[model samples]
Target: MPVTDVTTDPEALTMTLVAEFAAPPERVWQAFTHPRELARFWGPPGWPATFTEFDLSVGGRVAYYMTSPKGERAPGAWEFLAIEQPHRFEVLDSFTDERGDPVEGLPSMRTTYEFTAVDGGTRMTNVTYFASNEALEQIVAMGAVEGSTMAMNQLDLVLEGLREYAQGKGTQTELLSDTHVRITRLIEGPRELVWRAHTDPELMKKWMLGPDGWRMSICEVDPTAGGQYRFEWEPVGDTEGEAFGFDGETVLVDPPRRMVTTEHMTGTDYPSTMNDLSLVEEHGVTLVTVLIEYPDRDTRDAVLATGMTEGMEASFARLEREVMG
Candidate 1:
């Protein structure tokens, strides 16, 4: 559910996808570069993937294939051009024949993968460049956009499993008072990065999402005091026209330090709430504290009963990765 945006620019000859995972850079990196993990999520839903070769070093080459439900196999290869551990890498990917050779006259793309450590997780931005605008259009017309989106969605699920196996921990929440609830975690990055990720809409879109099959369709943020922000979540799948949205006004803002906002969720019966977010750095990590205060005890209890904490925890976990890289 961490895939926030997928876009194509024929004029720029590029296809870009921005996603975040609730796992550290190292863990996310391994999921991407390791053959076993890559095979688990490289294909879209209903397609099984198999990786015959995977080498992460510069000049390395990888071969893989995805078997469709009808048993048809589509093969591909990656010619790695550059690599930086737990951060970024570049590769030239292309379709391959049965012999593992690039198909003649087929369009190939040079992909750049950037991994950033944000709060406690990692944000991955993938940009694929074609040799020409025509080549970009060709692939876009061939359903690359839809296929890649589904594939990345699978990666989000894969990351959750990987984190559970490696960390053996789930998100924790605390009820501090009758009207206040708090969620705190030590994000694996500097305070500044966490601050920017929270305040900037571009960064926020990389991770903030609604429930499964739903995404933030609208995001507008003005981070200064007295400024306002808005977010709208709409079902991206077959939800039969269901949508929800929210907006907020910034009461106060201090870079890398503190922020106070008054938020309202539309189409909901609960009253507006006040949110206080504070960030502090210890060693090289950032400790993020979020306190939510409802208008009254009943309102707080009503909101809690709606299962908001689970979504909030997932959002924060993804936010952690958005800032770390």
Candidate 2:
């Protein structure tokens, strides 16, 4: 187990858990900063977590929910209090209502995380301070310790990069949580071309077509934050489906590296999805990563069941062959 020991103190009304990972502090810290990486180990076994929003700065808050096997949800929020690079951070952690407001009846805790470099690995000292002994006992009685142990143990797999979709391969999808999926693809071209292929309407229209019988009829892109992008595709001939399009607004953008958008169907009652796209170049190849968040588990399942991954693979293959080349 990554978690070596857990201790509780009634006098101080605090609980502390010590965990060691065979990873550096910087790598371990990245797991917390990246929402997709954090979601993999944030919930206990049998309950998967979904983080809809992540604000990494001090005084910023994050909203997340863990869904039980029976479809029950436990919402939570975290307000960052302090951050010291890759060494330490603190947060006010609380159980919240579905709207992400802290519940009046639940006890919130002041949690501190300290990461130290020890023996070429990192030791994380996690401490949660409660208001009173009763609050401490209340949380312990809820099996918080055991659940946390399980959750932390799962972090070893994440640190090992065991869950990365496909390495040195085409488009591949990995389920990060009940409502989140990550797709990655390595393009054998420069990073600039990859970015242009996504943002430039002329380039997007060439390779964004899903299958052989479909053609992109409309490709309007606005890459600035708060701007909108609309893409539509139609069956060329002898193709099987009606025309479809997607419209989305840019939530954030860092040219050549990252972009975020909230996407909705051009004409449908379907729930909207948040997509975080990032590009990283190593050596001569560029890797494109997309983390997608669905509204709920049902919506996630329905979307994935529609052959979304395969369609994405087809588009990415076209991008490599036709656009990036």
Candidate 3:
């Protein structure tokens, strides 16, 4: 199986997370359905999970409790609706009270987990449905999306580790969080040098990937509010690549200081997720902060799972060389 892709639509209040695991669908199914295996990798890093009850059947109930490092505990329960062994499952997940009773009036989410064979492994998708768009919006605004993405990334690590362990390769997978992969590099060069590297077409070509099929095409930027920019990452050789392009609307443009862009990826054709870049000077060092806002947690998680931190580090290193030279 290949890497998974996760995405969300905040306006629609929906999220979809897809991943490919190096295991058969049945194995993956067992990992998700079995209480003992599920408890081991269910929560975010440092969060301990205990499954009080898990009934893997339609009309049955599954309940669990999670305690953070600080000793605070949160309980949740789920009612299974459809259960097809090793292939698909549907359930309604909700918060529970101390007595193990479901909390009334709180949002209960409907979730469907689907598994399919791809290559020699399994392709799994987790789709969560909220009651209403308003509820979805509220949760996203509260950062649930980002937090969930982090959790899924942790799940990826767990699944990968399990696969390796099954093959007698390693002991366990290392737990990782979103912050671990986020990039924050302090630059010593002037702001203009940094800005030019990001904005200038010639300089961008040296670093950024181009569009599919076309080797190198035109790169343009308006650099002002309401302005647009284009990015292309072309394919090499015979293999076809997903077209890499975005038409972004500039929301903020404070040259030598900050630039904010709202970009919509081509496939979704949705509103732009916000990207904010800020340059601040402290004791002669310029700190660059790149903030990207996605539609939901799943989308953010998918990006983080990809080795984004390493990629950013390399790109910044190249930028450093270009600016210093």
Candidate 4:
């Protein structure tokens, strides 16, 4: 759906904006409540916001600063006046000094944020109130309308990212132990669709590439327990025989639920890994957890340090589009 409006009424001393996001209400709420998530898209296109303090309860204060590319900074704060979980909240928004304290003699605004769950996503309505028409005009002259529209556009991107995450398009990597590294994602789609993506060769080829130009060239899956599988990859324009690939032996298999395998990369000096893939269905979403056991802590750390997580996230994002589409 389109934005309803972003209008400022100087007579009423109010400024309001409206937008919709392709995410659930709770997901949209988290984008506001979670500090790290809020920082991702809380400002205009160039000036990005960084939060030093974020507390969502009533009477709590949130402090942040927006840093421009030319090294300028604008500090601000929001004192939460009321909160109603995933539905609504009200805050007193103000200008702040470098120390995160409100600046004296500066006008502040009271803002109410209302979130409504819609059929396909969430509708966000924001209303800001100033003490006087002059105060509203002052901020309006500061490009509040344009800046907020840009910020909300960024929020649209953030909500799209969150939607993918909610559909299992995001990846989480952590050290389960000194030798075990766990990577997990809650993927949207049915269990069989997820299973096919894992086991079917053609579907695997669709999303198994690391970057844009790379390709998963050879995929073979003999999906039973004790079966063997191989996946080979190369740059799209590769002319040489050199290719990066992996082979594995399935140790256990349970359709749409669990699969255990030993993964051995063919061209790497790194240690082979044992992966336990578990898929559980809850509310029509499949939670896919992959626990990978490296030979030692050093090997696991080395893998992590390679910055492979970004590639995994990119790959999974494509996977969601391929499967869910």
Candidate 5:
């Protein structure tokens, strides 16, 4: 089992568990932050988890349920209180009803997860703080320790499969759910430079053009929260294509790390979508990841059916050649 030690301090009203993994901190962090990865082991062997909503931002909440072999569900929710990137995060965890509201009479706990680099791998310290001694005892009596161990023990297989999942793949698309899709591309460039290429309008105009026959007619970028951005594209000489543009305002911005924005096609009544973009650098290459949340399954399907993935791949290839190259 990954969890090697479990300790309870009644006086402190805290239960701490330490787990070690044979992987780096980033990979372990990803396992917890990404709903798809977390679902693989979030529940014990017999039960599987399905995250209905996963928002990895401060003040955002995550709602999920674990289904038993007999089709019973145990719902849970987390209110994110703090986040410090690849090191630590804190959340207010509670048992909830089917609607994701905290259940009355059930004990709620404050949980913190910390990751540290160790000799050969990463060590994760998970601590849960109860409101009182009675609360701590109540959870302990409910097989909290055993359940946690079983859930964490299943993380090894998930961790082991991550490297093989994305190592050599170029720009790849993953259908995270009916309304959510994740697209990732590992580009041959540093994180800061890649961020610049994305936020700088001049640089964006050069390589953001998808195919060879198109040109960016207008480009306006503001990579800050509440700032608006617009991009218009038209066919170049003799090319057959109509003009199109997109408009959106930045919702959240964490420079060189992450950004969340609302996006919609300009002048269209189509519902807007939220897109979360993140950049992580490893081994001299930066992985650009975008998680898009569509309004509904129909809209998601319609967008993906528009050769979106191919166009993104072409633009990313252009980014590598014309900009980063």
Candidate 6:
């Protein structure tokens, strides 16, 4: 497979990959829309794979299990949001259990794949949404960006293999920006508990917020559009830090459904950070997504360089422990 263009803007944590495959739109579409075909190239290489339940309709689900080389098996699921044969398919992807249950405190992302017909082939593009800029960075640090690129490349290989088996000429594969991080996780807990962990200041302090030295002076939420919120984090360590504060203006706040906030730090003159949270309930479990958008590439790169990814993963792990207990 040949990649025509692969562009990655680490600041926006966005990646665009453009590739032309030798097959027509229908063939490419079948490879993606069909669950059996998808499982062949969906995960990292050398992982044992199995599909549990596959329903291709809107609101339907596709669940599968993958066992690593060490014999550790993990289950994952995807909820179909939209499916247009031979053109586009959108789904919410996450890691789940054998019974199709979501785990706790992990982010679930929205993934959309589009197929277009070219002169003699098909063009495919994949767009993924993360919960927060921090979450995206964390996934990048964990190598999701590279893993996904590899997965896509493997998809190209699968296409070529299919062509070979069918006695057709093999084509190619490509990438646009390969910088974006693919974030997906399973959160296992009741909706109300997860809601409390998010909105209740005391509870949030226990998990979402950092420890004693970096305490939050104020954490108030109106839970409505045009509502106001202020969160201040002060450092206590001996090391000279950025020595700044954090603030955000709420743009959209719909309780237990979704919330969007524009965040600004004290030193950074620009209100460059956008935070988005979404919550859903499945079989009594609550799944949440937190998306953070930065002002530009520089700020995004700076934050990534500061080990923010590990910090976020720790915070989320704390939240899971607190809630699951």
Per-residue lDDT of model 5, residues 1-325, tens digit only:
5889999999899999999999999999999999988987898644568899999999999999986533468999999999998999999999999878899988989999999999888999999999999999889998898778878976886787534435567789877567778788888889998999989998998899877899999999889878999999999889998999999998777679767788999999999998877776765778787878898999999999998998999999999898898
Prediction 2 global C-alpha lDDT: 0.85
- If ranked by TM-score, best first, what sequence of candidates would result? 2, 5, 4, 1, 3, 6
Give lDDT: candidate 1, residue 67.
63
- Residue-by-residue lDDT tens digits, candidate 3, 1-325: 1335667776666778787777889888988888876775576433446799888778999989876433457898989999888899999988899888877766778989999998968888888888798767665675665556555554443455422322322111222333222234666566777777777878876655422233435578888768888776566688575546666777776687667777776556555566666554544545555656666666667766776565566566556565545
Question: Per-model C-alpha lDDT, please?
Answer: 0.77, 0.85, 0.66, 0.79, 0.86, 0.63
Please give the ranking of all candidate structures by lDDT, highest first, separated by commas.
5, 2, 4, 1, 3, 6
Q: Can you give the TM-score per candidate against the true fold? A: 0.50, 0.59, 0.49, 0.51, 0.58, 0.47
Whose TM-score is greatest here?
A: 2
What would the per-residue lDDT of candidate 4 be over residues 77-128, giving only the tens digit for each residue?
Answer: 9999999999999999999999877888779889999999998888999999
Candidate 5 wrong stretches, greater than 4 Å: 1-106, 109-167
Model 6 Cα displacement at 227 (Å)? 64
Model 4 alpha-carbon drift over 4 Å, by segment: 162-325
Residue 193, model 1: Cα distance from true site in angstroms: 47
Q: Please report the TM-score between candidate 2 and the true structure.
A: 0.59
Off by over 4 Å in 2: 1-165
After best superposition, candidate 6 residue 307: deviation in angstroms?
Answer: 43
Candidate with the larger lDDT of 1 and 5: 5
User: Which stretch of 10 consecutive residues in model 1 shows the poorest summed lDDT?
Assistant: 162-171
Model with the higher TM-score, candidate 1 or 3: 1
- lDDT (tens digit, per residue) of candidate 1 on 1-325: 6788999887887999998888899888888988877876788643547899887778999999976533468999999998898799999999999899888878878999999998968889999999998888888888888778767865754565432322324345567567767666666677888888888788888777734567777899898888998998887767655677888798766676767788898667657888877665655766566768778889888877877878766776777655565
Q: After aligning candidate 2 to the native by TM-score, how far in Å is the CA of 157 from where it should be?
A: 10
Residue-level error in angstroms, candidate 4, position 73: 1.0
